[model samples]
Target: MSADTDMEALMDMTRDQLHAAATRYYKKRGPTEPDVALIEYGAARAVFKDYGRAPGWFNRLIAPVLLWREASALAALDDLAGVPRLYRRVDARGLLIEHCPATAWPQARAGDIAYQRLDALVTAMHERGVAHGDLRGGGNILVDDQDRPYLVDFVSRIRRGRPWNLPWNWIFGQLAAADRSALAKLRVRHARHLATADDYERHRPSTGFARFARSVGQRIRRGVRFFGARS
Candidate 1:
């Protein structure tokens, strides 16, 4: 079967074929984590996060849980523009995702419209009940040649609560605000000349939950996963 050269190409190749043909990789922390690999076929480009390559014990005990988290987030944010598409799930240990063709936020030379578009994208993501929880760091964002924004890396996302879940819903609000605050800070960083008073206000110190999330959420998550694996 021949898939089109567009996003359909992302689903054409099987997992093993893509893995063997991966041209490059990013963020492969340890034997305990997954390998973020780039797979490029004729007209298809994608990223495969393969926890299958992690140690047997780690892969069996913990990888599935993290993989599930990312997959869940991607599923929840499906069809959202800034978020990447989830191509396919490769067993319980890995998943395929769209390879965003854009420059990293830190390195991007974007203008006010790009920043405005980024803010709207974040707002749309929040409306879908997911908080990035890490956009403040800037590594997760990307900008295309047209200066459009893209948010990547769903591993750190925090999901919102149901209607009856008041406490957790409130927490989601704080974390979502953190995402906005992060964006405002980024706008000032990349194009300060266009930064407005509202941007400065939103960039102020975040709520406690948001603050903890932005500051040490990854460390705490890693620690939890490590300890959970031991138990």
Candidate 2:
């Protein structure tokens, strides 16, 4: 990490200033995802997700759609705890997001409270009509110094449908279950002791139909992700 971009230097700068000042990046190796940067200005910091830098048509057309989708999810979840705050849209191609000060879950050592909190957070998120379709991947969870859990990367989220929409509502149910199963998967990986007999029984291998639903859910997720990335 380089020195923080100073406040004085940023005073007269536009939206692009902080992006230009970003000193570190993550996942620059990936071709499919957006460019993520850690932008700092004095003590203020943020994560910038910019698809403007993506290559080819994905940059011009697909990126903004994906950016808007994620931004909408953030807005829907704006008041929810344990999720990053949306600062503002940088442009059609990017977003400025609040920085969660935490270690990635895969690297961070956390107590059972973290898992518990994560479960609650996921539940709260669902109650607000969002299902995070990709938590099983683990890269999107974070644990901070005080053991609170944080969820990031809302690009693949699915919203609950209106009551009159049966099919969409059913899809939402399956995705919501997937979210719960994802939390169970987390326990299996990072805190197996936390999984009780009931947890094992309830979340045991998904039934054939459940498996089908999960597959459908993931397909929808990938469809959304790619559509946004490819837009």
Candidate 3:
């Protein structure tokens, strides 16, 4: 199907239509707050994510907003090559997104070409005013068979308006810098041989906020693992 036609059809689909069209569903492990599944419908596949059943009062309150934020980010970044196409929102709880059959960065042998592509993708995202707040996670960065990078999971994206926007632009700048630093660290870990001295110079030590964010993410991941174990 043509990209435009497929996107149009997806936008028009209802939650019932998505459910009916789904021929197969495989629940996947995800971080805390979201229930994720891979759904196959005819020749197409999509990732279905619902954050309604998250544990704890805090998580329950923030889940919906996070889902919406991700959707908004996807819309703003639709022109990017590696970012997934947003299909449709399923009710207030769920989202159906275009599925890319790619493995996480940690599982793939990310070569120089892959890192270059990833850097370009990140640059593209920043130019469009969206900062993927969690690019440091290996799972959020995927590698295809051709060694191409695909960025996923935008629940923490930060979008800024015009340059004249004061505080927001400043905030966006910091986050964009963080994104670059994260990429530099990733290169240092995965493709150190190809990294330049400037790349090493750009690397900054994680701030308290970054450390706190990582801690919270790790706790959520552990919560998901615990839930899976009990189930």
Candidate 4:
């Protein structure tokens, strides 16, 4: 079948049908713990992410929540440019998202326009009360064929509300700041002439809590992935 026909057929399928097809045909991509896969539906390619059986106590406890969090974040993003369109939630543990045909931010010295686009995208996300908490990771920021920036992996996103309230607000604020700082650093490195004074100002050092959170997150990811590999 043609790609378009394939995609339409896949989309037309019932949830159970889609799930079965994905199980049978999806090709595993990234690390196994989260079990990311490149799935070909009717005519389209999608990313299937399953965080159900993560290794380690901390990971197992949090994996389902993170999976839902990411799905919620993507739903909020909806049709915004630079944000992938979420297809469906395969189960409690999995989501199928639009496959971005893009490369990491490090692939090119993306000009000022790309940085501006990224800033605008980030602003839109914040306006909707979502913060991309882990923008420092190169893999999460993608540059498309036209050089527009697309952010992926919303598992670490900070949503607006209680739990995200009070002292948590302080941490969330730092995370938001870090996102801006990361963009600023990118502009400085790839498009120096376009770097604004504000960008430079926002690029200050990460707070202690931000540092600690990042460290803990890294350790968890490493531990879970290592356990997964061993298994």
Candidate 5:
């Protein structure tokens, strides 16, 4: 075999072993566990140039610093003015927002107000061609001292395309009870449907159904875990 081919094969093997090790480590540590390696692992190997300490091994391996840069660029566009501000790093976990204040989960009249704010935020997100992929409840929505609602956690948002709608019904289930019921109905109606980026482009400029379907799908996917067997 050519030297180039041998080098490529060796690199692939190394990546495979590294991924397996990382996966095992992540599984053992759990989703919330923060690993210092995620930040320094790639840098030590010269795979990364000037990424910050927040670039964990998992983030570097999966999302990569360049992808984050691209997302930053797209998010900076004026069209994304409605998208929430990404302030800075928090606890070596993710970005923090100064405007999105934290509030405890609401109840009764407060709950109703919170949902209204949430609906508006979701609508705004759709209008701007973005979908918060993990907008379940509690963590994603923060209430300020004035009871105003703000959005947090932008890691899993779908900024560029439409996807199958059923999964969002599952996500809606994780939010409020009323939303769960609403999403379940939509999921039942469009259970057989599938969508992609093309569908968004084709359906968005003309009909609103495509956008609605995409939102429903994303919510279902995000909330599905709550309705299934406990993890």
Candidate 6:
């Protein structure tokens, strides 16, 4: 087949098949972990340099598949509230995410505010026919200048109607030990975001909050994949 024909055939492959092919390609290249590289995203995908850090063994073990899968999943839910913006695929290893420079949070304790926004965002996401497979405290949440919390990762958003094999609390309560104020702020933000329990009730299976979440989740997934890919 001609080169164009070969490329066309590859485009028809399933995500799994493409992944397997990419895996084989990388393994032969003597893969290394990311080098703390900050990806400048604006396309669908981008090649990112991974930062070498401690716990190399662990990251190396799961980085390849996890990174790709996480980013792809988040892309699927880019409409969720707090989910980061996405443009187009730049490459297999990099994504063109909406660039939001580092800005201040809405409230005093940025961490706390971020955590609070995360809580609301997650709740809103759940209501909108999706679940964040991982809502851990550390890297999955960010706060905007207005103290608006954004959920950054979504390597694992499943349809609400689908069956989940993990524990709800384990997945949702990843930041249970984070500062109490942050958590509280998140809860308040969610309640406020929904505009009241009545709003939550009205949107119970598809809340409006997911609109923002979709973007936040995308960014989180992108960052995770970028960090985890090199190994």
Tell me, by TM-score, which candidate is best. 1
Colliding residue pairs in candidate 4: 3-43, 6-42, 6-43, 7-42, 7-43
What is candidate 1's lDDT per residue for 115-201, written digit by digit as tens? 889988999999998988777768889999998889987777789888999988877887787787888888777788877888898
The pairs that clash in candidate 3 are: none
Q: List the residue pairs that clash in candidate 1.
A: none
Candidate 5 C-alpha error for residue 216, in Å: 12
Clashes of each: 0, 2, 0, 5, 19, 52
Ten contiguous residues with the weakest lDDT in model 6: 23-32
lDDT, each prediction = 0.80, 0.77, 0.73, 0.71, 0.37, 0.43
Residue 130 C-alpha lDDT in model 5: 52
Worst 10 residues of 3 by lDDT: 212-221
Give candidate 4 misplaced runs (Cα > 4 Å): 1-5, 8-32, 52-61, 162-164, 197-204, 210-231
Task: For candidate 3, give the lDDT of residue 143.
Answer: 91
Cα lDDT tens digits, model 4, 42-147, are 5677777766444455345556776788899999999688898888876676687898877789775566677779989998888787888777746689987787
What digit string (tens of lDDT, one per residue) describes model 5 on residues 41-66? Answer: 22221111112232245434433433
Q: Pairing residues by index, what is the TM-score of model 1?
A: 0.86
Please give the range of 10 consecutive residues that has the lowest summed lDDT in model 1: 1-10
As a whole number from 0 to 100, the lDDT of residue 19 in candidate 5 is 35
Models ranked on TM-score: 1, 2, 3, 4, 6, 5
Badly placed stretches (over 4 Å) of model 5 are 1-56, 63-84, 88-96, 104-111, 162-231
Segments of candidate 2 deviating more than 4 angstroms: 1-16, 29-31, 201-209, 215-231
Native-to-model Cα distance after best TM-score fit, residue 133 in candidate 3, in Å: 1.0
lDDT of 3 by residue, 1-231 (tens): 765665566556665565556555544324345666666544457887766445554344455677888899999999898999888887666798888788889879877888889989999999998887777657789999998889998876778868789977766776777678778878777788977787797665556764554334344446645764454
